[model samples]
Target: SNQSLLTQLLSGDEKFRIASFPTDLPLNGMGSDAPFEFASKQGLMTVMRHVHLVLSRLYPNRPVFMAGRSQGGVAAILYAQHYEDLAGAIAINPPHPDPELFRFTVQYLEDKANVLADLLHAPGVTLHDRSWEAYKTFTPSFDYPSMRSLSPILTLVSLGDPFNLFPQYAHALKAFTENDAKNQLYILDAGHNLWNRKSTDTYREVINLQAQFMVNQISKVRKAC
Candidate 1:
């Protein structure tokens, strides 16, 4: 699904190697790495920090950028919130990290006829109890103004995403973010998934725009330095 997106980011003859790994979070489940406890947001960030360290070490000369979609996108936001060393992050349709908004978004998915099961995880008519437990692992807590991060973020959200009401979010999450916070949100024409499947044309365009945003952002930083 993200093949076009990844390729576009690596376009322009750039030597960007994505160190893709399955995050032990419920989004992708366990991978080859020995599974450890990471039910809390603290636990989640602990693993993410290790991944950042490895990336920084492996590519010492490069500015590290994080990007992800859906849950992965939330991970990217979480990453930017904690790490000033990051160059930037691109979050595509991440659910809110606030406890109320996040929980509401979760329930919206549950009510919407297997959207969670089909789109977010395995296909099933009913979301399992185990799935709910995965979400319980995190005690969601994030405030835009108090974030300890300095890196900028580019957030892309679909205009029609019912799960996270854009209108309501604009007052708090979006409006507050613009009042000096580094995160930037851009609305797209697609549905909740951020892809124009009915129109069938924007997946590539979305990726290209994201790539361009990254380039422009990096260029500004380099010039500033």
Candidate 2:
């Protein structure tokens, strides 16, 4: 989803490669006897570690553009946070999990028809307990500050999204990230799916802007080198 548009924006002129990590059990449920779920905070760190290894082996010298939708978006930010060498990060409708926003969004969903709880209770929901626990943990008391010193974090969201409530997030996350490197948030007219053809196209435009900025920065750095 991110690659197709990223390529389109470079006028079909840039080279982009994509890889995905297979989902693993929550740490220990599958084979090892170590608890499947470890510290919640460490989850991001674990994923970033894998990304660092992949980049080290695959593109030792080339710049990388990291992008993802939803959870992937969160992972992208986590990756950029750990790996400053990332050229840029583009995340769409990413869940930020701010307490204030989470409180309000959960209320909105419950009032809208218990969609929040229903999703949590869904039979097929993977990591259901962990996800719900995380959801509850994010309810208005947690100090959720946006991570500073990360690569450019561009958040693409939909104003009309009934599911994610990106409208409520723009301010909360932005305020937390204002002092960070080129942090940005853009809103579209569509719903939760940031990759819907129209919404995805709009999201890509923002990615293009960030990519250009990163490219220019890289050029300057290369010249200095």
Question: Which candidate number has the best lDDT?
Answer: 1
lDDT against the true structure, each candidate: 0.62, 0.56
Model 1 residue pairs with clashes: 39-137
lDDT of 1 at 4: 58
As a TM-score, model 2 comes out at: 0.64
lDDT of 1 by residue, 19-114 (tens): 555554554221223234345556666777888888789878567778876566767777888788888888776655566666766667567645
Q: Which ten residues in a row have the lowest lDDT in candidate 2?
A: 25-34
lDDT of 2 at 58: 81
The parts of candidate 1 lying over 4 Å away from their true place are 1-24, 27-37, 98-100, 113-126, 136-139, 142-148, 195-200
TM-score of each: 0.71, 0.64
Model 1 poorest ten-residue lDDT run: 28-37
lDDT of 2 by residue, 1-225 (tens): 545535554534555554444443232111223244334446655766676668768867666666766555666666667666676777665565666666676566546543533443333323244444544453233233555645666777766555465455766666656766567666666555444455556666655666665556566556767
